[model samples]
Target: MASLTVQFTLRRYVARAYWTAVVMVSVFGTMAADVLHIGLGVPFAVSTPAFLSVPAAVFMLWYPSERTLSIHSIQTRRREAFRWAAALATFALGTAAGDLTATVG
Candidate 1:
């Protein structure tokens, strides 16, 4: 029997999709807080979770299925652009959902 070990090296650039996702989530979260405070004329006592985040997660799944979800694997500019766009869309959706919650709930 022979023993084999496989090691993976960290690439200079990782998918970084997680970073974008975090940014988007943070933006939406902040928006939700601000909207609830000012728009509702109330303190941060009650604020709903970002529903838009759902779409963001979905976008990640669909995009990668359509293409690929690797940091070093993304070899095309179009894929990169799509990634950014998905992040932006998720952020925007989160903002809208937050506002809607403030208005309705």
Candidate 2:
């Protein structure tokens, strides 16, 4: 049916958007972490924990607002927004941690 076809297309579009967001956020997060150290002269020891707190705060807000952190519960627009925020925060945290480790070694 036409409705089914439309639904399938919409789902595909959403999936593509999600993936694109992930890639873009990852790149930006890495760049941000690098900038904090290279541009501002902030050491990794300071930046790492600063970056990590972002995700922790995001989850603290998201869980209270949505009542769940499970990926399977990301069905509504609000939930999707929370998911994206959390994803971005996590990417930023991971990038900072990786950079910190590389610098320490």
- What are the per-model C-alpha RMSD values against the true structure? 11.9, 6.4
Kindly report which residue stretches of model 1 are placed more than 4 angstroms away from their true locations once superposed.
Answer: 1-66, 69-72
How do the residues 2-67 of candidate 1 rate in per-residue lDDT, one tens digit apiece? 100010122234445445445555676556556656777643333333434555575667565766
**Judged by lDDT against the true structure, how good is candidate 2?**
0.75
Q: How much is the lDDT of residue 98 in candidate 1?
A: 54
The Cα local distance difference test for each model comes to 0.51, 0.75
**TM-scores, each model vs. reference:** 0.39, 0.81
Model 1 has an lDDT value of: 0.51
Worst 10 contiguous positions by lDDT, candidate 1: 1-10
- Give the CA lDDT, 0 to 100, for residue 28 in model 2: 75
